[model samples]
Target: MTDQSDKLFTARLADLVSLCERDGTYEFSSFLDERQCADAEQWCKTNTGSLRYRLWGGYENARRRMLAVYPDYCEEYVEGDYPFVCLTFTYRREDKLTHRDFLGTFMGMQLRREVIGDIVVGEGIAQAFVTEVAAKLITTTVSKIGRVGVKITDSKAFELEDAQKFMDISGTVASLRLDCTVGLAAHLSREKAAVLIRSEKVDVNHHTVSSVSHELKEGDVLSVRGCGRFILSGINGSTKKGRIHINLRKYI
Candidate 1:
C-alpha cells in the first residue's frame, strides 16, 4: 500500500474502533483487500486494548474480508450480524470467464472496490462476496457478466473450488531470512534472491520488504512477481546439517 493511502485507511479504521467503543455496538467496515486486512488487524492488536474485532470475508480463510469491530463482551458473531452476502453467478462452461472479467463488469456497474470482496472464479460459475448493500442491487439488475448470460442467486456459501489451491513444497534453508525463503520459494539462487529483494520484487504479507535479512515466520505469505505466491506453511525442527526444515505451500 502507498504511504498516503495507508495513513488514510488507518485513520478511518481508528474511527471504526472508537465508534464501537463509544456506542457499545458492532461497527463494520467496507471490504478490505489482503494488505489492508493485515494492516487493520495489526492496528487492532496494537491499539484496541480489550475490545474484540473480527476480520472475515464471508468464509474461513477468505482472501478478502471486512473489518467487524465489536465490544469485548460480545461473544460470537451470527450471519445476521454480518453485512456481506455471497452471490453465485452460473454461466455456460463455454463462456470461459476470468476473474478480471467478473470484477470489470462490477466496476462497469459503477460500484466502488471496497463494497466487493473476493470474486472466486471457477469452471462454470463464480462466487463473489459483496456487501449487503451491493448484493441486493447487483442480483436484481445484473443478468450478464460481460457478454455472457449468467444466472445470479444468493448463496450461503462460497464454493471452495474457486478458492486458491496450493502445491506442497518442503525444503531446508540456512535461515528464515527473507532472501533464504524467497530463494527456496522462487527456486532462485541465494544471490539471485538477494538481488530480487533489492530490486523491489518481493512482498511478505502483502507489504514490500527490501531487506534480505528480514526474518520470516510460519504463515507469512510471500508474493513474487514472476513466481507464484507462497505461504510458509510450517517450521519443523532443524536438519542434521543444521538447516532449518520448512514447508511451503505455493499457490497453483
Candidate 2:
C-alpha cells in the first residue's frame, strides 16, 4: 500500500484525505478491493491528522469495502450514510450459477469494478453490493446473467453469508520471518518460499513483500499467488527447542 513505486494511486489517496479535511463533512468512495483498502489504510495513517475514517462494505465480513472519511462532528452519521446498497438476485434453483457469473456479467456491462462490492452467490439467491449510483444503473438494466433469467430487487435488510471457506494450518516454524511462515502456510520448503518472495509471488498484508526476512506479526494476511491466501491467526508459545508455534487459516 505504501509502495513508493505506485505513486499515482498514493497521490489520489492523498487527495481524498485533503478533501475530507477541507469539507469537514462525510466523504465516501466506491467499493475497494482488499488491496485498495490496504492502500487507503496505509496512506491515511500519516496523512489524516484529525479526520476519522472507516472502510465499510455494506455488510459484515465483506471482501470489498468502501472508504468513509468524516470529521468528529459527523461521526454518528457516517455508518448509516455509506453510499452502497445491497441488491439481491433471485434465480431458479436449477440454474447452478456462481459468483463469477454475476461478477463477469456486471463487468461486461462496462460498470466500473470499484463500484461493485461483494457478490454472495447461493443456490437460488445471490447478493451484490454496489454504490447507490451504480445500483440505479444495475437495477434498471440488468435482468439476466449470461442467459439465465433472474429477478433483481433492492433488499437493504436482506443479508447472505459470504461463502468463503478455509482450512486450519497449525505447525511450528523456525521463526516468524516471512519466509518461514510462507513455507508453512503454502507447504513449500523454506528456501522455495524465499525464492517466491524474491520473485514477487508473495504478498504480506496485500502489499508485495520481497524480503524473506521481513518480520511477520500475528494477524498478518499473506497471499501466495499460486498457492492461495492465508492469515497468521495466532502465535502460540515456542517449543523448548525454540521453534515458534503458529496457527494459520488457509483460505480454500
Candidate 3:
C-alpha cells in the first residue's frame, strides 16, 4: 500500500511540474472554493501517497473547512478580518528538485506581498527551498536579508508588530553611514532592537552578532538570520552626542 501511494504521489508531482513548465505558471489559488476542497480531501483520503492537496481562501472560510475536514493537520491563524489565506500541501520525497521547482515558479511570478507560508517538507527539501529562494530574491551581487527573531512553528506567530520592528532596523533603512554623530544617530534604542538582536538571531555579514548596540559602518551588510539582510550605506550625520544617524538598504 505504501509503495503504491509513493508511486502515485511522485507521478502527481511530476505532472504538476510539467504543467507549470509548459504554461510558464500554475495557479491553484483560483480553484480553491468550498466545493473543490471537499472533492480534494475526499480524493486524498483514498489515495496512498504522502502528498495531499489542500485549499486556502478567506481566512474564516478556509479555516472552518480545513479544520472540520482534516483535523489532524496543523493550523494557525493570522489576525484580521480579511479573507486572505495561504493554502499548502505536503509531499514526502527524499529529493528536493520538486520543491525547488514549485517555489521557483511562485517567486518568479513576483506577486507583491504574496505570503508563502513556511513549507514543511522533509529536512532536505527545507534546506533546498531556502537556498533557491535566497538566490532568486537577490538583486545586487551583495544583497542583505533580515531575520524574524522568532522561529515560528505556525503561521499565527507572524504578527504585524514583529514585522514593524524588523522594518525599523533593516527594512526602511536607506544607508549605512559612517561618522561619530552618524553612528550615534544610526544607533537604534537597544531595548527596541534587543527584541531581535538579543536572541542572537540577528547576523552581520553572515555571522551572528547579537549586540544591538554594535556600531555599524558603511559597506557593512547586516543579515538578520531568519528575517532578511540589509546593506549599510553610510551615516547621514549626528543628531546629538552619543547619537548618530545611519541608513541601510533593503534587499527583499
User: lDDT: which candidate is best?
Assistant: 1
lDDT values for all models: 0.88, 0.87, 0.38
Q: Over the stretch 93-199, how does candidate 3's per-residue lDDT look in tens digits?
A: 44333444545544655633223433323322221112223333322221111211112121232222112112333222322321221222345443545656767
Q: Which prediction has more favorable lDDT, 1 or 2?
A: 1
Q: Number of clashing residue pairs in every model?
A: 0, 0, 33
The lDDT-based order of candidates, best leading, equals 1, 2, 3
Model 2 residue 110 CA deviation (Å) reads 0.6
Instruction: Score every model by TM-score.
Output: 0.88, 0.89, 0.28
RMSD of each: 2.3, 2.3, 20.2
Q: Candidate 2 lDDT, tens digit per residue, 1-252?
A: 445746877677677778887877888877888988887888778787988889999777787998888888998889889988889999899998888899899999898998899998877888888889888988999989989999988865646775667899999999999999999998999999999999999998888999999999998999999999999999999999999999999986
Structure candidate 1, residue pairs in collision: none
lDDT (0-100) at residue 204 of candidate 2?
88
> Which predicted model would earn the best TM-score?
2
lDDT of 1 by residue, 18-60 (tens): 9988998888989998988899999989877778888888777
Worst 10 residues of 1 by lDDT: 155-164
lDDT of 2: 0.87
* lDDT computed for candidate 1: 0.88
Candidate 2's TM-score: 0.89
